[model samples]
Target: MKKKVWLSIKGKQQTQDQEAEIIELLTEGELYNKDKSQYILYKESEVSGMEGTTTTVKIEGDQVTIIRLGTTNSHLVFKKGKKKYNRYETPYGDLLMSISTKNVDVEYNEEKDPIAIHLDYNMEIDGAHGSRNTLDIQVKH
Candidate 1:
């Protein structure tokens, strides 16, 4: 079933908080359960500067992965208390980035499917502390 998705992100750095939000249709989304793990697939529209890009999110077990492809290419993996590194490709160039997840919270629907996800993490780029971040995703059928 297709659903409406609302995403909100907040970043805190140097005592300042910056927030951004997007509300869009979920192009492709599904939830799967197997063994002791659950998986989610979510895709959304291309954004402004990210012209040809498609944003895809996958959640499995306690890890969340986000990928952007087309105009820009990047992969980010967030696992609680673990730091993961990756390179972000942009029009300008490539950027080295690291993400350390602090917490992950999930809310489920009556069907045992995920209806919301909340993540708290810290990010660093090129070895410098970037921001503490919070991302919330909610879906409605």
Candidate 2:
């Protein structure tokens, strides 16, 4: 059993809000299965004065590759490609944004009553500026 977690980012320059929603839409609807793969969707919103833009990103494969989709210049678009594990520099700090064999790691801790999954992501964005975004996801079943 596996689940899909969706993260959305919104707000204005210098300040951005990141929200993540996890949904179990698989047939088993469980979260601690080692045989299943999890799906991830990420989105970011940027606002400048009275205008704003939102970008949606998707990551597939068993931590092999990452796919991103969004809009540029107010037009819908998709970025289909693959990149080796790498890091970039940003306003907040240094970031390593990659979806490779060793980039995205998921661990299941069963010491608690319900299992928990921990995700750590270090990434960067280009706009008027860039900021470091960090998120923690814990799921109980």
Candidate 3:
């Protein structure tokens, strides 16, 4: 069964020569579980610069993957102590992005649903030093 859920996201990005940039968002989405994996489906907001895109977050064990489609397309995977790369396509152009994951923390509710997830990773864009980023997300029923 699919459940309606609310998502609260807090993101921080720190890059060399720049102070930390923080982004916070609150949105509603659908959450479901299948094959022992949890999935969240949500629409991208204009504030995120991808108004027409749909975003899906998949969580399985210690790995997390985010896939975005529509106005922009990208697939990113985060696994602790591992690195993954992908291409991000936007209206402007396509950019190469990589994520070197530092940590993945997930907290679950008594019902076996995820209540919170935190990710710490270093991101590189276009082969340039990008930023150290952290994403803290809280899922609410």
Candidate 4:
């Protein structure tokens, strides 16, 4: 089945335009799947004036690994980081965001709506100073 995932980031100190830009970045990328029923969707955004990158990688496996890194450009700034973006977060105090919607313990709920995968994201604006944000997402099949 084809899957579509949506991501959104919100913060108190972020501007409306910045929020929109983040959303755009999240939805701009495509989900990567190495096997059927298992996939990964990654999204990232940079806070203007803030030198950092935030990336989210949704892995379908039971255990997911999140790594944060530091980058000088946006998520799409280059093609090399595109795939590795999920493995590490840029050192820019960016949070690695991801959600696993595949539940094997319970049967699929056909009547219920897709659940929103919420992730707490924290990033440092400067060395020690930073802000906290929430990433709300939904994965649909």
Top candidate when judged by lDDT against the true structure: 3
Instruction: Candidate 4: count the clashes.
Output: 8
lDDT of 1 by residue, 26-82 (tens): 344555555555555444344334666766666777887878888789998888889
Predicted model with the maximum TM-score? 3
Instruction: Give the whole-model CA lDDT for all candidates, comma-separated.
Output: 0.68, 0.30, 0.93, 0.36
Q: Which of 1 and 4 is the better model by lDDT?
A: 1
Q: Is candidate 3 or candidate 4 better by TM-score?
A: 3
Candidate 2 on 1-141: residue-level lDDT in tens?
334433322212122454433332211122222334343323333332211322222222323222333332221111223333444433445444442121343444463222222223333333222333223333334
Task: Give candidate 3 regions above 4 Å deviation.
Answer: none
* Residue pairs with clashing backbones, model 1: none
Spell out the clash pairs found in candidate 2.
none
Candidates sorted by TM-score, best first: 3, 1, 4, 2
Model 2, which residues run further than 4 Å from truth? 1-36, 39-105, 109-114, 117-122
Ranking by lDDT: 3, 1, 4, 2
Model 4 over residues 8-78: C-alpha lDDT tens digits?
Answer: 43423342335422432234423444553333344444443333543444344332333323463333211
The candidate, 2 or 4, that scores higher on TM-score is 4
